[model samples]
Target: MDKDWIAYSECVWQCRSNNESSHQTIGSSQAFSVNMASMNEPASTTASTTHQSQTEARTTSSMPNITQHSLDHNPDIFTIICCNDSFQIALDHSTIATLLRVCKRVRPLLSSKVPRFHSWWRNVGLWRPNGSLRFALTPSEQIALSLHCEYEGIADRSWLDNQADQGNATALFFLAWIHQIDLDSQQSVNKPKREAICQQIIFYLEKAAQADHPMAQYDLAGCYRNGLGVDQDPTKAVDMFRSLAECGIPQAQVALGGCYENGEGVDQDYDTAIEWYSKAADQGSEDGRLHIVFLRGWFSFIGHGVEQSDADAFNRWHEVSTNSTNPVLKPIATHMVGWMHYLGRGTVQDKPKGVNIIRENRSDEFPLGESESLAANWADINSDSPALRKFLGMCQFGSDHEWLCKHLVAVCLIHGFGTRQDQEKAAGIFEQLANEGHSVSQLWIGRCYSFGKGVSKNDEKAFEWWSKSANQGNSYGQWMVGCCYYSEYGVTRDHTEATEWFRKSAELGNRYGQNMLGDCYKNGCGVTKDIDTAVFWLRKAAEQGFENAIYKLRQLDQWL
Candidate 1:
């Protein structure tokens, strides 16, 4: 018989149990005998079934010749047949039932021969409800499938432990990952439990690393570097990072660059660091790009690894300010940009615009006003040291609280509190805040301009800021405006304007304002000459211990 006919005959015989008894056999007994003879005959002669069944006894005698031993002894013939695509397709449910019915010996032999049957099932997208391909199989069969499938349901701790005990590298790596995740999640775990978990993670990670798992190698190196369940070994960490960097892992490249930059485990080499950082940046690593920018800027600024160039520093900072998405770095970069602009370092000096940019980008939270009780006890709180207030203010600044932080920083700059006194910086900060509508800052800015503490003395600027503060109803600002008018500091000497501002300040109970108003009345500079009104204002100032007012009153009393 032809090989195709024999395979078809075997399928029909095996599938006999699936059909009604009437449809069990595919052809007459004579045809089966003739086909069986054709298997043994030479290629030249064809076995004719029509007259072969004339003797029923001879046809029945050929049935026992097709035994299991005949097929099993020449198993390669069956193997070739079964390995065919058509054979596999035909070996479905009904065919399997038929094969079992035709000969029980064939089933066990096929099972032994085709050990990857479950793998084939998986390859064909067959999945059980439990995610195991061997759903209908016994526990032993499931275990056999698990060895090859690596299914998620089969990856419990117990199974992984067993596999790891048997030296399965993949199982060891997965076990390490599981333990690491557990340790990270249970922060409040007991010390002993945490240490135990860490040790297990290290043990498995090391085993997997030895097995050449790249992620395990990276993680194990980190453990060594940090002394987590391992001795601190910077050399080993550097070696691992170097290996992975050669493999083009971006994170490893960055780590290797850091090692070169800091001389942690090797000689410090700026060229090597830059090379590795560039490699990581090419791979789209943000930290790599940031480090490159920072390193280049620092080197350019100090002429260390590169020639000093403020323009290069400015370009790097400008890029960070404009393009970086990091919240903290962006603001810091913006501040640097403003500083460069103000100092004319690689940029034209534009103090007003520079200060404005810094003020706008700086933090917005006002920490000082957050607590009313704290504000009430400010004097007592700051009595310990002159620098205490400055330190507290910088803490707020570092925490991105801008309003009170700027005020305190300016105060520090003015008084050399906890830092070098920089009158120009102080004045700039005050001016920025003043423009932002801070009444107190406006008063300070006016004072700075009036006294030339930082910038050259400019009386008109002083009056302008003081006038803004006064309009905001600041009593000190009103008094300063009066002083400006009285001294013709910015505006023309206008005693009437001075008296009006002094009266406004006096009504608000400012001692200096009361004294100034008394003087205006006594001299008839603005108000009508009225000794009684002058005496009233002077007494008010005297109550507040204004010595000039008291001395003026003593002279007036002696004259009276």
Candidate 2:
């Protein structure tokens, strides 16, 4: 039997037959057959009558005998046959090639094996002969069907290397996995060969996993589960995850449980996916943990995977909510907890605590370590230092800091951080820094003038300083500049310009900008009337505690 035909035939049989053993026997080659039949389904249908009218193309090569063993060893035969039934139901509406392409995994293999008679290699970066993906295959017919497995394997390796170089961790992981699978080869590798490829796969997986690649974690777990390349130590794989688990990798935690739950490389004990799911849940990997919860619950409810205990599943799900670090799941867990309390699952029904938990878990506070610390230190050191004391007199005497820091030192004299307090020195420093085009210092100086923090009140001077900072994309300066434009303070009134600055600030997630943007939208000042957009902006600002925005949102909602 032709290998391709046998694979395809197996797919057909697999789809129709419900034999479990028969299905498992149909191996990798079956995937190819299913792919070919799928791809050509629609074409075959549209040209059904014509297909038969035209005689089958004759070839001089001897036909291979179809055998039961061949059909029994491929996934393609089963899947293809299943698709055949589906195609018959909608034959006129679908194209065979289109259907075949749906099975993405088998498409390339099928394409490689097809006999190409009149094809050209022109395209790059894509499959198909005219497209990229050059395979070393010969054409016995119109399609290129004589591809060598070694050539494909080399291509796979190259593809994986390219993906890794491009920093696509997921692709890198899958490519390594494909290498491990080695579907094209029939013989089991010698110990040396197997170890070499497996070692390469482990290297690729390690690189990807360190880069927080999800698929890499999943496959790495599988490797640990099966003891492929490394020693069959599930505990080592689980131990590989201190960093990943803490860094919020959900899949890693799931894999880590294998060691704990089965005691494969650790101690065997049933944890029911609860402990791992809790860790994953906290990292916003609720989807992954949800699968665990479902299985655990199903089993406990009737003991499918574990001993029967409806209470155990219920309690596990509760933990999935309260202990989860994922904010999205917090709300779902909150609701579940509320329902559980209402129904008296375990704890007394406490609606208020559940509500509070949901509110608290909506969004985790991002750490203000590097950026905030830098900004604050810069603020403090610049405002303090004894060197600023000597400079203050010189600054007042029309002398200035040789550099921006000198000016900041003078401001420090006025601010009394390291020098005797003197507003005059501070004002002088502000003048120097603002004139030097230091955006942050300019905004600060503008703020001082606007609020009369250290200088005589001056709106015009404030606007000038704000304008300079706004030009450099300072968020606060942009906000003030927008205010100036909108209020026509020391400038021409232009809502369009106000809106422009507002949009710039809003893009940076500034609450003040969000508020102004909502106002602009509401009044049709600089933008077209957009009630929805206005509401959205207002809500964002309100969430950030912008009082005016909150008031406006409430009024607008009432109107709606």
Candidate 3:
């Protein structure tokens, strides 16, 4: 074998070993055997020397090459390498370097030949005895091998035979985990293959994590974070993230930082976000870079948690805008770039570019149809307005306006617009809005209770709140109270009293009150019936889609 290939092979071999000493010892004997055996095969075929034999040899020789071409297309490279590494570590006590070397050689071999055997080979290599690695592993190593085989999604009968040969506590634990994950006692949804795999992973992960494996700690954190085969708890997730972060894992550092920034199972602290981001950033994390930029820009702009410096803020954003290789960072950078252009802050004046960037980032979001139209309409209403803030708030609430469909859903419930006159639903929404101190919502809630439009009737509660709103000069509340007395909903029936209230509401030119008064005169409910007066008020309310007035107007003269 040439010196360079041998050296490369040796390094690869080391990755599969438990330690440096093991690599040197293992490589000394097996390195040349593999190189010589593979090299001699070509010459041996050529020496066969008969036309028929030569043709047969050529076809068989080309078989590996054909398989190699096919294996190159399988896209999941990283996952395979990781699986191989995990097996080697568990079985032979091989280090990552040795595993990498084995993978480099075996991947091409498996890729060119029968790629289907990659998982099987990995499991075997993981459990293989140190000295007799080419054949079989020790009893304990075999159990780890079996668990790993199941974890990698293998289901061949031969694979089961291999597992039974090494099955032990480790294998049993892995099986239990696989069962727990894939088999739900309450549901028959678990597929046999996935159930078996889940049982194995859970069992092993629990055992290994308890034994202080960094990978297990990281995985446990993820399990808690997502409630994967376990209860989800952000606090437990943070704890796990912290433990793993202490061990210097980049992903754990990022996760821990997220907990600190959002106050999820931790205190909200920008300083901590900055601190954790820095730690992860030092390890070349793309996410860390993006977060650093965001935190620095936000803190610098507001002069909170970090020192004030617009130049520094823009510089941080500009750095991420230019430097990061992460795909997720691209959209975030585009968003911040758009903001900079829109505000003409630190960056060159370029609204068109900013808009383009925003649109580009928007491409990743849900397809906007009528929601875009609503946004455009909303924008046209106030060009120099803070509409972006409202839109962003909606996004935060998980209701992006992707459809642009105009929905008076909230208003419809309030005024019995579409489905049904639901005062209970209306009151609930009013309460929601009123809690935000929106005067319109507060007034509507009072009216809903007072009239029992879709809710049970309440008089004292309505009157007390209405009086407060009236004192605040709420015109709608004033009109609503007047209409209540006029209709005699919760009060004693009295036409004179009703008229007095109607006149007060009418002076405010409340169209609803006008329509009500018109009803009174037309029906002689409070005053003498008068068609002319009814026509006047009905025309006013019809313009607002008031159905009552429209019906009344058709009777007047067909002038509606």
Candidate 4:
């Protein structure tokens, strides 16, 4: 009923009006002004309360006090499980409160049956501890959440202030989250506007964290960790991580594990570090598993509380590279293993084998979206995307897998992927790897010799390289060798030899080989013609969506 509340409302409207460029609702202040220009209430006044009584309440009682139910839903566990994180992070605003005001917690039958120990409430806004959130939108919060300042749901400063006054921890965090969203980096800001925004965030985060809001506490730890709003205190950061870690938060567990490993706040305790990492790893935390494995490798040679041995270190890193499927960690570990092998520090000196280890590790994504039977091509990778830049950098360094790096560089040269296209350089690189007995490179060099792509077209040289790769069990190479034998490109036409090579490739699941073998059978080039057998082989290739196989099947009038 006091003028202070009215004065505050006016101030908020004035501020909102000034911030029109921020894309907030333009004239909401004027509309709200007429309805709430009086002494006490805006629209939420005494006159609106006595209209109806709930079945659970006395007829004389105003509105039934509903138990705290939340419309503020957040993501689950850790997306660092990635819905698991991506989906939850995308769930910032919007609610089902519009369609039905009946929230899950408001359903008396459900509420009594199951206890909702939701962690999402701590991250989002509005809890049952005020109004009901229907299955659709707006216990008023749906309105606040689903809109910007454009509609009734907009959580402008005044709305959040009111919710915060009502002891809404989520509201407090939201006020902070939305304000500093633009300046997401927690560095000390120089501009007055940014400084003010940072200060606002600190104010709300501190208040909400004090109220024991889980998200607020999580962010508060970040502040200390980054020295943003609070003075940098490794001890405080450690304390916060320890608290959340105990609550079964995987991110907190990893953070605490890192702190222990690095001696950030406590003495170096590798055992304790491993313990926290194991806990997080149990919850499927990749960082936790990675740290545990990395720690073993780090101290294996350093003699930090463990017996130092070069071989032991190499084994530890090799285990990581061989066992892990993580895209980032696996390559790093594999590189470490290759380097150790090359240096002859941990294992026997075998430079070619060391290079070969990296060479074989790139079966997956070697061509990286090039569609020509897993070979490199003219797919556009020239954009300054982060992934492309990182990939190009990795290829340039050649630190972890030298031969693998050369192969990728050759691919880049051929396709101009994040670099200049140079057919000659690519052909040279392929020839080098082919001499090193790299099967894929042997196949590529064969193609280069056959097509004169940076090299003289020579069927004999192409047939020679293809034979080498085919001997090493490259399926595509077998098909190429078969082609050379059938076409008499480098030697006399030998149908039996061509048919045998095609059979070998077909058995290894090469669609081209299957199609060719079927054709050989159909024409009796190397064996007696058998229409049924030819149909079987052609159908197999056709099932894999090979275009040539489908055409052959159509020519034979076979079911495809």
Candidate 5:
């Protein structure tokens, strides 16, 4: 076999020691290359056939006349090479070299026929005993594979399309990644546009997945689960996830574990979920390890899956809050840890340390959804009256947002979280903070006057307070002001003024503002009736998990 084809052959690409912990990087004289005893001739065990086959190979190699005519005439050759089942995948270099010599002959046909590329990779890809690699890379593949730069969408679509047209599996996978999936788990396109992009993504993913691309398989399963580009099929998602999980893909393992955990397409089996999570954790996946800890915590916290143990829950939550590499759940975990510490549920009681930990999380750095902060009204407070009073005093001294910290105590008083219901006390705190020039407190006092929660129902006062906060550039206050103008709740209905306030608040990244702005655009309340603009604003808020925005986007989908 000639050196050029031999150098790029899958024998060198896939051959590795059974015990190899990593990929066998290609070299001129590595495992498969060692079969070449001389510069011109490859050493082979089948000595009788080697000389004659090499002679015939050199003759065939010189003739680049492979075309439709050749393919039509050589039907037997097509069946032998084109069929994935026919591939024996011999370990020796001579067989691979000869196969490449054949591929070289059929290069013109294979370039346009994408299916042949799929069959080629499936037949030639290695199955390591350790299951470390999905497919061993050729040097060109290694360079092409680095194109997945999340920050830079696609530097050159034509270049990648060229590679994909030439039947490059890596290129197909990247093309899929680029088309529909955004880095932040938000699609850049609105629903109508996303549907089209999702089709393109699924097309490329299927081609690459047919070639045994692991990431493509994982993504395709995600599509099935969420119905991104297709119908929701939990069975298909679970099936695909199980295949990759068995092949030691950590993300797939975690996904499979979740399927078992939640009984999505399978019977609920906590033990099985734990096993899968453990396997992923063993492979050094941070999310996998966290899942294991969380499962144990959940069991103890809920007292259903395993014997109840507050100590176990506290320890696991502590580990997640203090030591986990994944930041996704740290804020929630820290709060739980602090609450338990203060209550002396598991460890020795340390009120000061618990207070300190809770206070530390009051910073803007914590992951804040539309609601759910330490000061937010809906926090699951189980602490008693004495403990609540201590929290109230501690809240007053917190370094971040003094008014918000005090608002927590007010919410506790109103809700009777651990004290008697007292709206008067809550309204007193709101009025005092509003007088102190706190924008959020002004918004709260406005709500009190509008709803008559703790103050006399007064629309004029509500609008006045809302205006004061809006003038200070508070996003929530701005949204409230827009609402009053739009609905004539506390002011004369004025769509133009409402639109301006919504625009200002929406630009500041408030979900409520975004949803309202979309509403204005949808009905042409102030802005022009533009469905595209409405969907754009609504989708932005929906991606941030706003329920109202999500509902609006669903309503808009019927038009498309």
Candidate 6:
């Protein structure tokens, strides 16, 4: 055999042995293999035959004359080289060089037909037993490979720094990521160190971004958007995202859509947002699909971008309700679909189906109370359920015993359930009910003021309303009153008063109040420090599946 073929055969044999040993060491691994006629060749071949083969290889090396014919006629050989283990082994510089010398047709094919080879090498590393092949690697490639290997073992960070200093964009990006991780993990007490790391991260990220490293551009855009280690600049963030979106990056497409939708750095354009969202969805992004469904429903229902079409709204919401894998979004879409059915907006009226959907998706595990039952009955009547209306006499004017219909109407206005959303009207109704001594209405009035839903946000007003409901023995109101005192929201910070209110709420079986009361006991906030009392209340809340209480109890157990 010729020297070039001999070298190629030796390299292939070495690679095969290494692969077998690696599989054995890792315990059941699979690797592709190449079948070569050279492997079965005799130990001896005349120099004349070797020379003849070399001449033939040279004559066939001409790309236009040989490559197309080989690809057309010898498709199996091309498939074996590209799809089999030979492609992987040829990634090694020595093997590829020898292969090129033996068969020049491979050079143009590899260069033109498989542009993804370099990216695959960079991401997955070369398939050598000793890890990545180092021959012919640029400084950035070296730093990237080293950082990639750090998941398996420790890496030399100083070498990465040296590579970055040598103007390696990838090394700079990698170093920035490392420093960002360090800053995240460092304690608040290490302020100077954290600040230094943050500055270094920003510097390296900016340098790498300017060099057009995709990840660096994405990360730097985020920093600009959030004012994290950089001046907040929505325009810059939009520009970066647009650049990446043009390159067909799905995440960048999503961000660009959000920017357009919110008018952050561009005009608010729901049509543009939908267009970008559709692009991302075409790339098989679940989030993109969800965004498209939501935007379509909102635009159709509100007549914002597209023409208002109840049928379109129903179709979009139905798609999400039935097909979405996101737990949070699925329930929301289901509720919207149920609302449409209940109101007979786009589909036939189906009150039973609507009610069943709401019941199944209700977040609270507790059975519906009398008030909830009354509200459900009111909804049935509102949906024009003839049997329910007759049975409850709800069709008659002024037949709303206990003000259930009025309360349900207010809730509908507040949430836009069956009526146009009007927070002001909801708040007015709630205030009237509060004046009539309805504890739940008092609590809702407090929430409205606290969040400025319909009235000017006033912590003092919120506290006053909460106190009224608390005096009427509302557990949630009592808990809110305790929180007000604890946080000094609308009153002086008084731990004793906070604890008293928490105790009252906890006694009424409020899990949040129970957790707070336990914390107060543990920390000696209002009452004397008592570990047993703390554990008692914490266990009560934890048993009710309060996540905070469960975590606190676990911490206390560790202390014990």
Q: Please list the C-alpha lDDT of all candidates, in the order they appear.
A: 0.61, 0.51, 0.49, 0.60, 0.61, 0.61
Question: Candidate 6, residues 1-560: lDDT per residue as tens digits?
Answer: 23433443454556445544644664321211111111111212112346436534643232223233334555555545543443442343223333434454554444432323333434433324544332233222332333323323223466556767866666687678667655655567376776677889999998876654565777788787667777889899999888777766666787788778667788878789888888888967777788788667755765554686778888998998788865445655666677667556778876445545655554432122222321211122222222222112211211243343355456555554433567898789778888888776788788888888778999999999999999987777888899999999888999899999999989866677899999999889989999899999998878766678988888888222
**Per-residue lDDT of model 3, residues 1-560, tens digit only:** 13433443344454343243433576423332222122222211112234324333433221222113223454344335434444334433223212222223332322222223334544434223433223222222232343344335344445434443444333333343334433444365647765555546665667655533444556677777756656778799998888667656676787788678767788777678779988988966777868778666655654555566656766776777677754444444445566566446667766445544544454323111111211111111211112232223222222222111011233333333223445466567555665555454566556666666455778876766565555554445555566556666555566766665565555555555667777777787777788777677667666645577787777766353
- In Å, residue 455's CA in model 1 sits off its true spot by 32
lDDT of 1 by residue, 1-560 (tens): 25644854564554443333323354322222222221222222122343233322333322332345336556666555544445443443223323433443334443442335444444434445665532123222222223433334232346447767866555576667657766766769999999899888999988866654455677788777657898888899999888777766666787898778767678878789989989999966786787678667555554555676889978887887787765444555566677577557878876445545654563422112111111111111222132233243333333243354466567556655445668898889878889899786788888888879888899899899999988987666898899888999899999899999999988876667898999999889888998899999989878766689999999898222
Over 1-560, each residue of candidate 4 has an lDDT whose tens digit, in order, gives 22433442343344334333222453423222221111111122111232222212321232212221111232221111211222222222111111112222222221111112122322234334544221112123322332222223333356456666766555676677766654655466668868778888898888876655555676788788757867888899899878777766666787788677657777867799899999999966777887688667756655556776778878878887877765544655675576566457689976445544544453333324313213322454443332333355545544234565577667667766556678898899989999999887888888888888889999899899999999988777899899999999886899999999999989876667899999998888898999888998899788866678899889989863
Q: Write the per-residue lDDT of candidate 5 for residues 62-104, one digit (tens) a residue.
A: 3232233244555565544433222322222233333334334
Considering lDDT, which of the candidate structures 2 and 6 is the better prediction for this target?
6
Q: Candidate 2 on 201-245: residue-level lDDT in tens?
A: 898887766544444655676676557666665666666543345
RMSD of each: 25.2, 26.7, 17.9, 16.9, 19.0, 17.5
Ranking by TM-score: 6, 5, 4, 3, 1, 2
What is residue 97's positional error in candidate 1, in angstroms? 38
Error of 1 at 326 (Å): 9.9
How many pairs collide in each candidate, listed in order?
5, 45, 33, 20, 0, 0
Give the C-alpha lDDT of model 3: 0.49
Best by TM-score: 6
lDDT of 5: 0.61
lDDT score of residue 100 within candidate 3: 20
